[model samples]
Target: MTPRISALLAGLLVLTACSAGSTPAPSPTSSPAASPTAVQPASGPAITISGMTFTSPSAVAPGATITVTNSDSVEHSVTADTGNAFDVEVDGKGTATFTAPTQPGTYPYHCTYHPSMHGQLIVG
Candidate 1:
């Protein structure tokens, strides 16, 4: 009876050991690297003031650079009622650039050559 019991215990231990060894270890291929992330930087908007009137955008963005292009044959100037003004005396197909004020306000401006050619820029 002792010999039979010892034999059964040995068989159980051997089976357990075999099962543990047979189980496969996790493979490196099964795991993957963490996904990469994309980051974008914050930037200010742009405004293009052209033609007999403001082109591309009629309104001006605060703290943005306002670029004025004179496509007409006559010379034009940007004069604001609040004393914030810029002169753009360019020949036909010429271009000029000016920086808009950071302060938020309403500015009414017009071309000195043609008073009727008026426009308004609202900056916030």
Candidate 2:
């Protein structure tokens, strides 16, 4: 065969071989990153730990139970920043509660494990 005709035949063979294969796979779709759940409003006296932050209602009644939940992957605890007012520990994906102080004032608190994690409890 002529050099030109041979090249044309080789190109046709390559095209035929490629088309003989199975159907192509579908492209994968990207998924959204997981997000932490919203902090549930404190029904009465409760403190929640989500996204590595402590959250509480504006004010809680004295002598009431204060619930704390740690939703992060690491352990965290609630410790009174002053006077040793209250100390509670909640493991990773765990829940715990402590009784509110009797005095009516703002009680500052923090995570003993994480100094940057802090919050305040208003007793009134």
Q: Pick the candidate with the highest TM-score.
A: 2
Q: Which lDDT tens digits does candidate 1 get at residues 1-124?
A: 6999999999999999989868687676652443245345433433334556654355566767766667676677766755754445445566666666677777777777777777666787
lDDT, each prediction = 0.64, 0.86
Give the 10-residue window scoring lowest on summed lDDT in candidate 2: 29-38
| Backbone clash pairs in model 1 (N, Cα, C under 3 Å; residues 3+ apart or in different chains), count | 0
Runs in model 1 deviating more than 4 A are: 1-51, 56-58
Q: Model 2, 107: alpha-carbon shift in Å?
A: 0.4
Give model 2's TM-score versus the native structure.
Answer: 0.64
Any residue pairs clashing in model 1, and if so which? none
Per-residue error (Å), model 2, residue 24:
51
Candidate that would win on lDDT: 2
C-alpha root-mean-square deviation, candidate 1:
14.6
lDDT, residue 118, model 1: 73
Q: What TM-score against the true fold does each predicted structure earn? A: 0.51, 0.64
